[model samples]
Target chain A: MLAMSASDESARSPGVLIVDDDAGIRENIADLLSTEDYRVYSAADADEALHVLEAEDIDLLVTDFQMPGRNGVELIEAARKANHLVPAILMTAYLYVYEQLDADRRKDITLLRKPFDADEILREIAARLGDGNAPKR
Target chain B: MTIPPAAGPKAPPSAGADSKPPGNRRTLFGATILIWAVTAGLGILFSVFAVAIGLQAATFDVMRWLLALAIEAPLAAGIIALIWYSRNMHSATAAGEAGAQALAHSEAKYRELIASAPDGIFVLDPQAKVIDVNGAGEELFGLSRAEIVGHSFMEFVPPERLESARSYLADRLKGLRATELYEATFAAADLKPLHVQLRSQVVRPSDAEPYVVYIVRDVTAQREALRNLVETERWASMGRLASFVAHEINTPLTNISLLTASISRRVSDPEIQERLKKIAAQGRIAANITGELLKFARPGAISPIETELTDLIRAAVEQTDAFRKPGVELRDETGTRSVVCTVDPMRIQEVFVNLLKNAYEATPRGRVRIRLQDLGSLVAVSISDTGSGIPPEIQSRLFEAFFTTKKKGEGTGLGLAISRNFVASHGGDITLTSEPGKGSTFTVVLPKQAPGVRATE
Candidate 1:
């Protein structure tokens, strides 16, 4: 009897699933996106995130690189095989290692570093959501 | 007191164009005989003329007068000629003897120089075989003079280094190559390894054949001492790098704490409020790691206080009279801003004073510059002097406790040692670069982030 009318009529409310090992980070992201009126979901790790992706539709995947097992890139690939074309935005503390990823994946996925200002990641999310004309910086 | 020049002694016969030594005796004999015959003939002619004139002449004995003139006149001339020849021969012998004595004294002194030297000295022929060795050489190789002389110099070189040693020597013998110095390992008579510093020279004496002089100093202890010093400096440099890494991480940690706390203030949702608190806690955890790294880089001793680095340097420059004098410029090139750092102000000011005084003393009229700049992650404060630099031999020992080049009563030698301790306590390092006659630069590289800010009023 939890709210199921979320995806029924609101085409404007895009669903996003944030995944990280730190529950606090995932909660903060979900809370921030929820305030923006997007339908936000979160998971503690990749395993749990995959479960959420299979059950419900999510428009975007925001995942952290370092995790206990099955890091962000692997989780994204696994979700893609399940017929989920969830465009991803990767978050990492290490940019150098991230740059060495497959060229196609690097070109498609958006990268975000931690300790960014509140406006920065929000703008990236808005831009990916097809909200036209947000400052890239 | 003017001593009178004595009346001349008997003059020796001049060995000029006329007075040849070989002809002197024969020519004098010829002249005596000729003069005697002419005088005797004249005396007889006079006596006969008197008897012929039929005058009653006084008693005139021609035979007696002729005999007396022949005996006395030629004998006097012969004695003078003999005396002149002997005197010239005596002077020639004395001069030759004196010259020989001086040459012997010089040669003895040279031999003594080699014999008494602390290092091995070898004289080698053009073939690179040893022609001679001094007493030290014999002791160094554990060989007698006979065994070492005439042996190939390469024989004493350690087997591992023989080829390179041979090539180094070969380069020197290729003409006009008189001086070359190198380090090599040599094997003693007992096959023990001996580290040596060798210098070669090709000397050409006018009357003697040319030879190479190989001066070898057994430098095993010196090399070990130098290695220990290098190792110590390397560890110190690594410590400095670690502090820089800690500082770079620290800047981001600050952003994390500030941003997360700011987010917490704007948000009121209960679930998110819990999350924001966790983020702030996690930032503190990250900061703790940086703190541990900083403590590892520099041990905790003195409590550091926040102070503007430029102000400290300026105050130090003003305190020392030498820095205030005319014609000498003490420039604070750290720019116009206050770059804040956590340090012991009094201790740091003392460090600045020491560095400034050193620079001023070294430079009589040129520039003594102090520069503070951010080197990406680290803050560097440097004092440079356009002065006669510390020689390389002394540079390594500049930070050693009680090591000073200043005169007695002018320095206690503890200034640099204490300064290094204070800087090290604050996760910083002091380093020196000196080129003799050019100048010296003393730089202190420090971290911008303290372990945790305790900026006191």
Candidate 2:
């Protein structure tokens, strides 16, 4: 299942790295992904998320937008600058966060509201990562 | 009838007279006049005899008076009768003046009581003209006595009830002294329609013409309060029904999602399989959301149990570790006494988690302290943060439902409100104290064994 080309790896199944300040949410999301047989990893905040990104092969990021320090948006920008071709899903309780984001950056990302349902998070993740389960747009 | 403690015998003399022999004043006046007449007659007869003897020898004046009266007893008796008549007339005139003074005092007292009674009192003549009204009556009608007295009672009563009221008054005057009960709308002096309960009783003084006395009582506030109670009950019933519906939907929806996922996992067609999986996932999510909504609709169901205070705090902190700021220290300052309380542990932890989360978010670089202590029968727990405290403007409404300072996407305003409800249900109280720049502290106090031991939650 290993790919030799960088683009092939980037285009592979999404590697979701959950960065939330709530352990229950992180655990629930991880548990949800595990039940679906998707490889999932969890971090408490942006710093831990970055550490995981550096050490592991990641294709997608799902991080909360209001965590301490550089939040989900900052993480995505940093990851992109580091030659990481990953699409991210930004989770926040604030709807205005999406409005504030640049239009170009928003195209590659989706926003999830807190207290979110497991199904919505998974569907959004699949759509953003171009999973074969989602209709191609 | 036995008098009340307030009307005991030791009450003032004036108060006693009202309850004692009612006609004693007239008897005492008659006795005083008779005594004054007899004493004046003796002095006048002696003066007349001395004047007759004055023409004789001055030395014989006193002796002559005695001897002359003894010799002409019949003439002396006539002279004595004349003196007695003059003295009796003078005493009678003085008694008349005293009686008049007494009458004036009693009249003044009667006037004072009628003027000062708290109940709205009104007097109506046989023809239904307002005779007299107290200040309370004036206020009830929003008019001065001068304005309402000449006006017929019908002017105040609702039109439909006016004729009936007139008949009632007529009947009261015919010795059928019964109280009439009627709820009618009256026009206030300001022309506002005031709902009132009017009771007309026939007041008949023995010598005076009978008048129909009306007692008007306003019941608007009481009626409005009852209406509000009924409205509140209706909303509560609706909330209960909505919760039941949500619970019903959540159960079956959960089952459907479970079945769908099983079917999708067994499918062989990859494209169809993926779509089915997504559907199952979305279905599960919908079910969870329904469950959350149901939780909000229904009141908490768990019965409180005696639980350790420190244990609850630790559980909440552990549950919310993901939300805590990195590098932020958590410190517990619990006294040696293991503070225990009867409460729904899960719900109490939820409250703690919310407060801790808010505190964690408020602080940037300092420690968050959680302290617990037992103060007699009550246990207190405080969570303090060293971050930027809550602003003063938001503190007043911090626990109000749907009030939140966090940006719209950041927090639901329901957390603190729900937390307050949970704390209150335990027979406990919660308070928040904050300094705009220094930080904030939230304190919760609960009884050792939940609040209502004899009642069910």
Candidate 3:
């Protein structure tokens, strides 16, 4: 699943995992991605999100920073420990918390401030995935 | 020697023994002289009779003469001793009278000192009764000296503070504590509460009983100022918390906004699209409010560069000229000289723009004037408008966040507050002067070089 050929990439839809404690935000983001020809999985928290990561081959992980029990940063760390080196996007309303992360760790993750335009997040996802069939206008 | 005559009735009371009546001295002198004369006369007569009766020879006998001489000498010595004793008694009386006069003078001096003191000085007897109170003490209690004296000090203390005040006095009198400073609330003549600071000590006079002396000062104003300071600090912290809450709400607002836009793009029905547009606009309004709150809460960083202040002010005036109402005129009075200074250009420009816009908005048909000046170590920009000025009560709260005189949907009330924060971050300040019927002027002053920024010139 990690090494798909050009022909397979065009045939199979890219999978995205959306995690947030807020059901409204999580479902809205899932609805947007599904409309863009992407297969989306949703979770309410880090534990549920990790289970989905283990069960399905997710191409991208999008999560919120502040949550119940585990935060977005820790989930990203746990995913790497599970040998899932998927590209990640960390969404936060708190700029100070994002700034507090280790520089090297932050370099690998794309940060999206909340209340951002839909076009902004889509642009970041497409750039990170780097596929010709990525979501377009 | 005879005793001297007494001084007359008009003589000073401190005249010592000399102040006695003249009639008494004359009587005493007369009696002394009479006793000596009578004794001498009797002796002579007795001697003559003895001779006549021939008890002895008519010629003098040496032994008899010697006995007569011895008797006369003793009488003379006794009279001299009486005069000496009277003189010494008079001297002692004089010294005692002088000492009493000196004591009276000293007591009068101390009375004057206490009367003139600024702090309320109270002299209390052992029973805590007010034996004496100064002029200031009278003024403090709003009562005359007659009303304040002869009253228990506890009578002036409010019920809530009476017990504590009693304990403090008791501790001082009993030597149980050495703390002389205390604070208490006292009731004035009209029962108004007075916050006072008292310094009291036990005064032990050798010639009198031990008593308490208190130096009291009114501290109500100081306490009120301190309370206001604490309240201001509390509001400042609340502002920070409010900004944090605004940040948290932004995420959901983003979801609402983006989701609505997404749906609007996919829908083909004109009616649904129009409704969706309204919802998006409302969401944007909420977003704008939170954005302004964040700006006032955290001003972030400033980038300083060497720039001419005259140019900066001109640009701000031009940007805000659009806000001028019909018939209102704007004039730029800045001269040609370049007043170069190290400052955050964007932040400082915003400050000027905010002031200029406020000036233009205030003057409906009057003139707005903007001027720039270069002081040696500082620079100033003044914006004046010929408009109905702010009332004094509202002027104090003008810079407060969310405080506005503008109508609903016309202002967010964060413009001046954020502008002040920006200027303060650059080590500057804004000042205002206004007259009710005349006009208002706002002045922004900044140092030649921003704090922590190296001089570029």
Candidate 4:
């Protein structure tokens, strides 16, 4: 369910950053998204994810909203301030965060539930990148 | 008239003599005129006697006849006395009627003020019976003015409060004493007890019997409301302290349970080891208690993630089945929709599980119904149980920590309370509606979207 860029033939594979407080969750999601041929960078929390984003040309971010120190929502806001256009998907165990999203941010933001299916995550990433009807990204 | 002082004393004081001069002025005037004519006649007679016998001795006799009328004027005096007496009698009668009318007007004004006073005023006789009551007084006692009048004050006073009522009446009977205010319970016609505070006094003239004046006010509802407010605050503070205590105890408790389980695994003898396993099992149960306790105290940090509500609700139902018996039926009513919302799925799942567990426990082998409806910006989920519903006594305190109807080992009573707190942290609330002997429905309402979305298809 991921679409590849036309410039992919000339350059490296598209990079995806994974930010979650739980290490197990970070590893599991990174492995699943990697099977679809996207390069993956994993961060334990907001601070680590910011370091990864600065060093890499990341196309997508999948982060949990709640974390120690800087929370996931705060991290998303900071990332947007640093780079004006970056697509992000926030993960939550609790159910009510999506309804609270702002209209501007919601247009770019996609939500994924915890313990989510691999196929569902891949398809959401494909749709958000404006690759309509593509099988892989 | 001036003949002699000696002759005045011997004269008879008849009406003719007493009216001889000023008292008989008209008669005197007429008599004098007659005398002058007679004297002139006598002189003419003397003169004419020389001419011819014209003025004779009869002329002198006519003068004496006029003098007699001047001395007694009986008919004229009688008429003056009758006229004076009649005029005095008529004026005296008119004055008496005017005085009577003024007295009647003042009495009517006194009656008006007594009847229309704003506060209830009751006039009780010395015998402690109601002599008069104002409109306000009759309305307060829920009795007609006629029913209350002439009735003893004891009739409305409940039997339990009769002594208090008598002491109150006794104070009113003591004239010139300080006024006393007392509260007493009275039974209404509907058999409900009423609370009344009366300010009563005895009023009287210096020599008259004392009359009781009572002013009554009702305060039953006001007092009850105040009591409920105080009771609620007490429970709320207790719950807050319990949560803090649980948090403090949980840290050590976590280590203790872990150590006990490790030691139980190291034990050697089979029988001794089995007993140790039991000990570890009990320690683990204690750990579960602290875990639930921590849920109440710790705040959840979660991110917005989209998931289907029906699927989440089903997961809660599945968890609830662990405690349900074979006879129990756990069912879900979920409509097909994207039913999408961004939430912390784990926390939301926790809330659903708590509600479903509560519904399962409320009924024994009864049907549990789980319903989910997408309500625009939010979603409403209801978990209902067909069990002996919550008693009214406990219903109000159902969310209070450590308040439970279950046996000591069965419930810590923090499930609903923690559920309430968890829902509130996400800007939602848990509400419980119950009817005794019928059933109970617990509803959890959560905002379907995250913080900033304007809902769209």
Best-fitting candidate, scored by DockQ? 3
Per-residue alpha-carbon lDDT of candidate 4 for residues B107-136, written as tens digits (9 for 90 to 100):
345446656666567777677788777787
lDDT of 1 by residue, A1-137 (tens): 01122554454477788887765566556655545556677887889888888876678888887789898888888888887887888876544335457677665478875544445667778877676422222
Report how far off residue B9 is in candidate 3 (Å): 33
Cα lDDT computed for each candidate against the true fold: 0.69, 0.68, 0.76, 0.65
Candidate 1 per-residue C-alpha lDDT over B108-169 given as tens digits, one digit per residue, 9 for 90 to 100: 66567668989888877667788778888999899998898878887787778878877776
Give lDDT tens digits, candidate 3, residues B92-118.
Answer: 556656755764565466567767878
Residue-pair clashes per candidate, as listed?
Answer: 0, 5, 0, 36
Please give each candidate's TM-score: 0.33, 0.41, 0.55, 0.47
Off by over 4 Å in 4: A1-76, A83-137, B1-116, B174-178, B190-193, B205-208, B228-319, B327-402, B414-457
Sorted by lDDT (best first), the order is 3, 1, 2, 4
Point out the higher-scoring one by lDDT: 2 or 4. 2
Interface RMSD of 2: 10.7
Residue A67, candidate 2: how far off, in angstroms?
44
- The residue-level lDDT of candidate 4 at B85 comes to 39
TM-score sort, best first? 3, 4, 2, 1
By TM-score, the best candidate is 3
What fraction of the genuine interface contacts, i.e. the true contacts, does candidate 3 reproduce?
0.42
Question: Candidate 4's residue-wise lDDT over A1-137, tens digit each?
Answer: 12222245524555678787766556656655554556678898888888878877777887887789897778888888888357888775333466466687576777864434444566776666555323353
Tens-digit lDDT track of model 2 for B1-457 = 1111112223221332243222444454455555555545654665676766665666675767665654465455555655765676567556666765664566566557656766687777778888778788899988887888888878887777778767767777886655756677777767777877778766554444555667888876776788899966764675577556664464345345544554554567889888877776666566544543444444444467778878888888788777777878888786556767788887788889988988888877788998987888888889999888878788888876556778854665667866777787777899989887788899998887775632211
